[model samples]
Target: MYIDSHVHTSFSGDSDTPPEKQIEQAISLGMPVLYITDHQDFDCPPGVPEFTFETEPYFRKLRELKEQFRDRIELRIGVELGLQTNIPTDLTAYASGHPFDFIIGSTHVCCGMDPYYPEFYENRPEEEAYRSYFEYELENIKAYDCFDVAGHLDYVVRYGPNKNTFYSYEKYKELFDEILKTLIAKGKGIECNTAGFKAGLNHPHPTEEILKRYRELGGEILTLGSDAHQTVHLAYHFSAIGDLLKSCGFRYYTVFKDRKPEFLPL
Candidate 1:
């Protein structure tokens, strides 16, 4: 009954695992549902030229996998779009034309810098980077209404030079509150990405404190994902997260179909 809502295949520049291999891995790992959300960041970095979207080929392979594994596991086709506040119109148009089961809007870039590179935070203080990252995320979430969920609410922490030593939602309460408020107002859910645990962080990307605050702020929709790049990582740590969500006052997890959310009791 586990559903891994975020995954990337070889189609994404960062991953080399093919579509079939992704499916085989899912099956071997006993995942009942998997969503292939390859990166569709149009503003490719200098060294990352192949990060563009290949919708046709990606969807074609997805259609094939859906039929081929219809009985064994549920295959959901999805896209993870890097949200830039400046190009909201283009992002909206591109996402509108697709028939994806789920869409995860992410903030991979901030102030023209990709934090994935160590140099992005070389001379900058962790606080400054975190502040800018939250600022960009707030703007992107407010600008784009096409996505179903916001991916990895605190993804910037993973690559920051200081790591998690200096970052926490409590330190950025004002910005964090605004982000949660905007998402609540827009009816967009925040994803609980367990990938942070895999990266050696003590908690998920957005800590349980943020999840509690999100729930307290009247935010209802919350989705879960491992942000798995490999098959063995699918639904990783979800059992613990399910309990965590309940303690945080969320009784349900969400799923999307035709861009609408369906709530499942936790």
Candidate 2:
């Protein structure tokens, strides 16, 4: 079975991709399963559109789409939550009450600022900034338990000074192992986000070494997501994901229905 577990449509503040267009594209690409994971970063930094969404409206729209395309495709509702030390209690409470099929808890902002800008790394050492990101990530996962999977474990590397070229899994091995152990103890998993390839990286997020390490630690719940924000990115690079997962020691990838995982053969 073919599916994309991470995608954002118009509902996400940063994306212009409409839900209908994503569905049409997925259908054309032979992917019958789709997850609409719009962003919701409560209390995000200024200078950008807020990541919050009107939940009622979002659910209503997805319900309509599910019914409209019921025969041709299977649709799932999900959200990409920007995890932080202080969990948004109101939003998390509301999310718990909803019928979302999946949740991808991710870290975008590190130490009160996004690492996307040069200023975030201006004077700070690269290793220091990257370490803070992981520390915050581990803290958030330990403090919050609402999500099914942790997304883009080494996302900060994507915006580093020299980018992934100067980065290595060995440098962050201890912290990464801690994060993996916590997730495994909590029964959570990580997504193999393919967005890095589209960003000109030679490999996917978290690196192949990280994936193999997760498997070696007895972790099993792994999901594949394109982390697509537009129609053209839907299932991007999915054609080779099977072999990639096999090489990483994963025989199955995961999907969720009603917030429960179902393993699909790689």
Candidate 3:
């Protein structure tokens, strides 16, 4: 099984799963290493549960758990920072200051709204909204070089009105290519998120074509993640995700330790 590189626990605003429970589940699945990547979305819109957490206790707990489970499984501390261009918070400082093994810079919000909510799609063509999302993603990484990998490269599709029914890499080839090239130029990676399957899409977050394009662009830092909020969702569809990566020309997937990429054979 591929190392589960993305996960969540009570430290995240949306997840309530205890950290220990997630670790136990990983052990039960015989996963040798698991990265606990809880969410930290600064500048969330009003009237929503802000996706921020207390870092002191968050690190304290994870450090303790890392030691407690060292023999059974390796636990890496990670954070999924929601990237935005206009937010006032110093994301670079926060990301660089943390003792993170992996950092996933993701775009959960576009134009000051999260697509997960229906209103993000209201009155806008699904294609337009999707383009805006990618535009923001490109802007974010270019403005901030603090993350190890871009989490869920095509996450906007998961909440699109058609939900990948009409989505294709060719439809937005220019933007996708720019995004891939920018990531490769910056030495950043992207995650193959399996949550798309759970979200009713036929493929993973980035889809097979995008993965192949990233490979073609000479981008090698790729990680596989379930984006799991609960134990049951951990390592979802490992066999299929692994096969898809190999088919897309990947013989290895990645894990992070001390924020450095380590490729493991697929």
Instruction: Please give the RMSD to the true structure for each candidate, in Å.
Output: 1.6, 1.2, 0.8
- TM-scores, all candidates, are 0.95, 0.97, 0.98
Of 1 and 2, which scores higher on lDDT? 2
How would you encode candidate 3's per-residue C-alpha lDDT over 1-266 as one tens digit per residue?
Answer: 67999999988888899999999999988899989999999989886687999998899999999999999999999999999988889999999898899999999988888988888889979999999999988999899899999999899899888889999999999999999999999999999999998888979989999999999999999999999999999999886777788899999999999999998999
Error of 3 at 245 (Å): 0.7
Winning model by TM-score: 3
Prediction 2 TM-score vs. true: 0.97
lDDT of the candidates, in the order given: 0.85, 0.88, 0.92
lDDT of 1 by residue, 33-147 (tens): 7788999998655664567667998888899989999998888889998898764348888999989999999999887778887777767788888888899899999888989
Error of 3 at 88 (Å): 1.0
Q: How many backbone clashes does candidate 3 have?
A: 0
Tens-digit lDDT string for candidate 2 (1-266):
46899999989988989999998888888887889999988877776567879889999999999999999999999999888776445546755988899999999887778877777787878888888888998888887788999998988888888788778889988999999999999999999999989888878987999999999999999988988998888888988889988998999999999999999888
lDDT of 1 at 33: 76
After superposition, candidate 1 runs with Cα above 4 Å error:
87-89
Cα error, residue 215 of model 2, in Å, equals 0.2
lDDT of 1 at 14: 81
